[model samples]
Target: MYKIYKFDEIKNELVKLHEIDPNFIDDKNGDYFCIKDEDEIIGYALVKKIENNYLLERMFVKEGLRYKSNGTKILKFVVNHGRGKRINKIICNNKDIENFLKKYGFKECNGHLELDNIQCVNQRVTEGKKVVMSSIIQNIFLAILKITGGIFGSSRALISDGVNSLSDVGSSIAIYLGIYFSNQPADEEHPYGHEKIESIIGNMMGLFLLITAFELVKGSVMLLISGKFEATPSYITILWAAISMVVKFFMYRYKMRVGIETDNSALIADAKDSKSDVYSSGGVIIGILLSIWISPVFDIIVSIIVGILIFKEGVSIILETSNIILDKQDDEFIEKIENYIEKNTPVKNVHDVYMRKSGDKIFLSLHIRVPKDMTVYNAHNLADGIRESLILDFENIKDVMIHVDYLID
Candidate 1:
């Protein structure tokens, strides 16, 4: 991983490029950042205040890493560094560099590249769609494998697990759609964005899983009551069951990583479901082995157990999504915000810190007391700084609104 930090040392290369006076290297008026890969500084960018806004004066990547995404990383760091502020211009004549900046929400005006605040599409939407589609494909393949094996080997447990995988395909598609629509940027009609769509999809998937579980249990129970011992489960059923466990375990890990990175509730719920499938398959394997050795009744019991597990996981997902839909306040998140403000700012008191979630996005509001003699402009600036710090320091915070009050003398 590449790390970016303020550049303190004057390097010979940068001195030649920017004609820096050694004294100017540590100037407080401008911000200088160097990109370090381990201990080696591979790139640097300079952003200086030009009147009210910022100007990207010079940005460079080492010749060896010029076309290898190092420049892109540096540019992203510079953009994020000034996120709540302004980056008015970037001096880049290279067509490749210009195209790269354009992709990251920059546009050329009078031959000067400037930040364009409006984004037509979000990158998370694309990543979420890709992960969800991968889940759908994997589930479909597993469903076919287990269903065919169960039919040929006379294992009701394997068949029940296959049906669960089939249901997951439907749920994955629903999650894909939710990720796509929920990421649509906020508009006039919908001021808060469409993030709640993810919670709604999560609820629907939970209900679907409940219905699927009921059917699985019903089928297994009917077979058990009929006293039907068709035949001993074959070795092929156990083999297929083992394969399902491995596959589901890996899928769970992959989806969980992406879900956490994107903070998508629907994807995370789907990952948890995948995890349950692994345990369910493990039970199927044990039941198949026992049926081959002793009696076929074990297969029926295992199927019922798998259904119960699915129902339990479904209830968990529903409860998780319900909290988001109900706009429950996250006490831990609020406490963190209060602690941050108290420790970092000059506020005499910080109170009323609150946070709520909309899908993966967080909205925060708080009140703070500043010195009574502070100028109105300085107070407004302080509030803006606080908002900016919170948004940058914390992940997924969409906005922060702070109410400033005069402190008691």
Candidate 2:
């Protein structure tokens, strides 16, 4: 006979369970139960029945006491609970948990079960947020420095560069909001999930960049026409511009790494924006140097060129995001995906391999050919397997729809 600890009392104990299972992130709202031996809690399990499926979110036993019967008891208890709840499938992505479930008759499927139809936690989304937040914080400090240095040093070009940095802060804020709403688990209203908003975020960023470009262009033209395109050259202005170039180059590389890792288009756009910042800061530096040697008119001229370049980039980003929203097909990626599916899954034929991007998330639709004699359940499981395989292969893919057609004799 043993004692069972309630969720509230032993929930904190599960924090250390991450070491046992890295996928076992502790969520307070999840149903938690702990197996206790007298006053010491030896094991814990967490589950959530989302939509119509059950998610075995996390379970673990203490390292020292794992060889005992505590783990077995917890597994039996949760399995029984799942059965009682009419949950046909309980899914886990962790290899250890998956192997353990197999011993109890849970077979590996093509795709992991979506708990109650809710999407699983996306690690890339988490990483994306971290990258965006870091960009915002760093941009704030840099913008302040550039704006302060520009005003005091009377360098219009540097002030405009400072404004560009400020715009990046706004873009990052928009990206954070996009990532936030996009990750809200798929619901009845939107079975495909809420990530499509990222394309809109991309479009907004594009529009913002274009507007900033317009303002800079207009200001530079006015200064040039008025014959007042002169900046009182200050070492402080050049110093800040040099600092900005270094900072933005680092940010560009960091965000680019995050963008590639997450396969997130919005973050990639942010990375490109950071790259543009590097160019803008570089332009500021060159303008300051020229003003020192040649004429201050070069500063305004360089600002105008920078504005035109940013406008060109803005158009490019808008077109890119627009293509995503329009469901533009990429034949190259489609072929790659089909080949990947063939290599990884049991399915022999894949057709109509259509791919679309919604923000950082990818939506894939494909028809799969299966044996005519296969049972519906078997086919469904195969489809699930294929889906999981695809997700594992492509981290950006959010939703996959596999249409199973009977293999004609």
Q: Assess each prediction's global lDDT (C-alpha) against the native.
A: 0.80, 0.77
lDDT of 2: 0.77
Winning candidate number (TM-score): 1
After TM-score superposition, the amount by which residue 248's alpha carbon in candidate 1 deviates from its true location, in angstroms, is: 0.5
Q: Give the range of the ten consecutive residues with the poorest summed lDDT in model 1.
A: 17-26
Cα displacement (angstroms), candidate 2, residue 14, comes to: 38
Could you give candidate 2's per-residue lDDT for residues 268-312 as a string of tens digits? 888898898888888888888888789988788878887887888
Clashes of 1: 0
Deviation in angstroms for 339 in model 2?
2.7
Model 1 gets an lDDT of 0.80
Against the hidden reference, what TM-scores do the models get?
0.76, 0.68
